[model samples]
Target: MSLPFILFFVFALISVGGAILLIMAREPIHSALALILVMMSLAGLYLMLGAEFIAAVQIIVYAGAIMVLFVFVIMLLNAGTEERTDWSKIAKYAGLPLGILLLLELAHWMAHSLIGRTPANGAGSANVMVSTRELSMQLFQKYLFPFEATSILILIAILGALVLAKRDE
Candidate 1:
């Protein structure tokens, strides 16, 4: 087996385990830590796929900035361990099968869509490196509205959090 394949499996397993941990953890802080582990492993996977810029953004933006915000909110709220809830019979019986169906549909769609597509390299190679300048141009030119909207949404979330905090005091 190739080294990259093995590394992919390792990172994939770590990410999946971290996701499970994130879901199962009772404490909000522990869940946040697990999410950080998942994000870092995803960054490693991105690096393995030759997306160095995306990997760096994943680590810096998600792991560093976003996680700090999440941790700060958790601390500010004085969040405690989660209380166990009893699941309804309908959810318990139907949710898993519906989730599995959704997963299978997604897999089918991805398999069909990616079957014969080569990486966007003109030379038909897999290691196409997207320059930062090109990426910025695409982001600013094509995706400007969506990007600005996302920032506004985040700002609103921050303001909402502050309002809730003030109300509690």
Candidate 2:
């Protein structure tokens, strides 16, 4: 296999392994650490795809900011101890159907994505065309409102987190 494909497979394995560890870990802090590993692996995958700007953004936004927030919240909650996760009797029936549905949805989406992708043009540049001029043009023209809206949403979420984390009166 080619180098890029090999790297992609390795990163995918790391990403999925991290996800599994995050889910199976009993300790919340360990889970958080595993999630950070998952995020870093995803950033590596983004780099392999030749989206250098997006890869950097993924590292900055998810690995740096979001993982810090996750670790902070895990510490704030003092969740080091393993919590009992045994489902109650009522949950058994509900959880079975939910799990089946989730699996079906995942399978369907995977099949759809494999079948419906548009082929990329041959002889095109492998790297993303992310010059400052192109970024500015797309940011202003195509994604202006959504970008502004997400900024507003992030501001509100930060404020909400602060309020929630404040000392109780």
Candidate 3:
């Protein structure tokens, strides 16, 4: 296989593996770290596709800022590994096959969707970067309400975590 093909496969594996690890990890911190890996792998994939601006945004916004928020919340909550619980035989037997089938279906769908949609004009070089002024104007004017609502939601999340972390009866 060609080198680029190999790199794509490797990054794809890292993305999938990190997602699976995030789900399977018992500790909140481990899950958060796994999520960071997933985000970084996605950013790498964006870089490989030559959308450097998008890659940088993913690294800065999702991987850096959002992940820091997640990690901070996890640490502030002092969350620990979940206690082990017994798995039902039906869940283990049926859920595994269903999950695998869903995974296969998703893979098939993605492959088919992407196969005919290669970047036009070049190796993703045709992606247009929006101007900083346009972005700021949209963020502050058009999307201001949504942005403020999101901030409120995050604040609520932090407050809820604080309340839940209290030891008071």
Tens-digit lDDT string for candidate 1 (1-169): 6676778899999999999999889999999999999999999988776677898999999999999999998998999987987887888899988989999999999888866685542221235656678888999999999999999999999999788768553
lDDT of each: 0.87, 0.81, 0.84
Best by lDDT: 1
Ranking the candidates on lDDT from highest down gives 1, 3, 2
lDDT of 3: 0.84
Residues 90-153 of candidate 2 have per-residue lDDT tens digits of 6698877898999999999978886547554222246644565676789889999999999999
For candidate 2, the per-residue lDDT at 25 reads: 89
True lDDT of residue 40, candidate 1: 99
Query: Between 1 and 2, whose TM-score is larger?
Result: 1
Ranking by TM-score: 1, 2, 3
Q: Give residue 78's error in model 3 in angstroms.
A: 1.1
Candidate 3 lDDT tens digits, 82-104: 98778889889999999999999
**Candidate closer to the true structure by lDDT (higher is better), 2 or 3:** 3
lDDT of 3 at 129: 43
List candidate 1 segments past 4 Å from native. Answer: 119-126, 147-164, 167-169
TM-score of each: 0.78, 0.75, 0.61
